[model samples]
Target chain A: MGRWEPNARGRLEQAALELYVERGYEQTTVAEIAGRAGLTERTFFRHFADKREVLFAGAGTLRDDLVSAAAQAPPGAPPIDVVATALAAVAAPFQGRLESVRRRQSVIEANAELKERELIKLASLSAALAETLRERGVAEPAASLAAEAGIGVFKVAFGRWVGEPGGGEFARIVREAVDELKAVAAGS
Target chain B: MGRWEPNARGRLEQAALELYVERGYEQTTVAEIAGRAGLTERTFFRHFADKREVLFAGAGTLRDDLVSAAAQAPPGAPPIDVVATALAAVAAPFQGRLESVRRRQSVIEANAELKERELIKLASLSAALAETLRERGVAEPAASLAAEAGIGVFKVAFGRWVGEPGGGEFARIVREAVDELKAVAAGS
Candidate 1:
């Protein structure tokens, strides 16, 4: 293999997901995952810290991307709109990855530790989004409130998108979720 | 000590918080907590599964109470209003316990595992609230949206209450937080 094998990370992820689905997350070993990917154990370690890390690595990137997106939103946009713009940016990457996302979610749901980690990731994302909003001159409770509301909308929309894959566009679902969140908040 | 001691559970909780605040959650032991409470280790186990449980016991009670309050909300109340009523119910118990609550929060904030548990508890509360809303003829997305919004408001209000203990009443803070949540959701 060359020093830089193309898509090595993607192959490892694909292999890990398939093994997790076929053999259950608890029973699947890193060696089996690497073998399935036609790569060495070292290659697997190179991509992820452990088996669970493969499922969570994207969360870190997602958090960072989301923070940057919110920070770069227009100078005077409303806080919620800024958050919506940030979340909407993430929908494109998820368009063709529905199956993998579903399988990954199932695996996470099956494990308590993974579920805790998922919640932690989401909480961290909310905190980061709040910090970004604060940077935009938003004040205390409002900044946190808007960021958290954004996360709530994203979570509800993501669940809907995963369960009803072809029902509507992910971005559209997110918009509607935000609107619903607003309506719910408005007690309408 | 008498076997039928009054408020044994409350005594154990108070002792646990004192120990956690003084010695730190990691260094504190169940035996010490029981000792401070003038109880035996067996008595401690009767009330809590472990040392961590001392701080989290109220979560179960809070969940139960919130769900019951939602279920008992006046008929035809909006889903969000039902949630607001449920949250307002919790504010009563929280009064006169600000010091203990502050200590408990500090301990939880000091430990990552405790923080995760806290988030899990809040998420569970949200889920239970959603189910109660569903039982009240509320439909999908709305139930969850209102429930999640309630949680968001509760967290923000709780933070503000803790940070500024003498600022105002908990229920009033919660009300303002809910209004702010509505404003944020509305992109105000």
Candidate 2:
């Protein structure tokens, strides 16, 4: 549903990841990242609050898209169903960037701070999803249940897509995971 | 399933809460907390890893209990049902400390770091639940689904309990939440 900053963001991310791989998240300087991308540190700082934020900048956009997608879903749809669609709507962005996504995951998984940031991001997203459900008139526990369940689906499917053979097509795994959640809930 | 060092932990917790309320989490030093509790800083550190640990010492133990309880549920029980039972296992401890729990929640809700710790604890508990399901021979995705759904129930019920007029007992709300999840999953 969105991009971070069009071409500039993409360039910074690519340059940053390359340096992080060659060096490391801790070793890579923001200035060097900007220099490698043929951009100034001022440009990098303008886009990212910190070096770590380069990896997390998309989270805000994703949250916004999720809210919009949930709003645009068919009226009165079940919470999980609406959340599933919202997740699906964001899948296309990942499809073309599977390699980069995996690279980002690799970097985050290796750093405790990045991992904490990810957990915080996930928690906020779950809360946002719940808010969407509440706005749709779903009651307390059910809205929370659906939201957490949606986050669960997202978490597991993302993990699988990262590790599964030829699983870079995130949309398919996400759809399958949603179906699996339903089947499991149906006590399959 | 386990007592938190009998009355010492609870007493210390109450004392700590009082200090936090009167002062604040940041301003209240360990010495002040110990003085309020009639204990020493060494005693406090023995029970908790750090200042923040006092707010979270029960969660790890609680998560282990929940996972063990779920794993031991009847073979024929649905995974979600098993998770519900596991979650309900804490009803006794929670009920006994409803007021204290509410006080803790208020303290925690007022702090970002505490909330992050809570989210991380919940995430870890969710992962543990999934692992237990897998051990019970539940298939991939099913285990994850049951775990996530269980967490959903726990969060909803916990919120409902916290909102009760006189501060609700944890068990009753959890039981009701389990039923609510069952109802929603059944599309009732």
Best by DockQ: 1
Displacement of residue B180 (Cα, Å) in model 2 is: 2.4
lDDT of each residue in A1-188, candidate 2, tens digit only: 13434677778889999888789899999999999988888888877888988898899998988888988889988777787899888775788777888889999888877877898898788899889888988988788877777787888889988887776678778878878877776767
lDDT tens digits by residue: candidate 1, B72-104:
999999887888888989877897788888899
What are the per-model DockQ values?
0.79, 0.52
**Per-residue lDDT for B106-187 in model 2, tens only?**
8888888887778888888989999999989988878987788778778878888878887666777787887776656554
Best by TM-score: 1
Residue pair clashes in candidate 2:
none
lDDT, residue B183, candidate 1: 76
Candidate 1, residues A1-188, lDDT tens digits: the string is: 35776787899999999988888999999999999988889988887889989998898889989998899999999898998899988765787788899999888888888899999998999999999999899998999999887887888899999999474688888878887887777777
User: Model 2's DockQ?
Assistant: 0.52
The deviation in Å at residue B107 for candidate 1 is 0.7
Interface RMSD for candidate 1 relative to the native interface: 1.1
What is the lDDT for B45 in model 1?
A: 92
Q: Model 1: residues >4 Å from true position, as ranges?
A: A1-4, A165-167, B1-4, B165-167
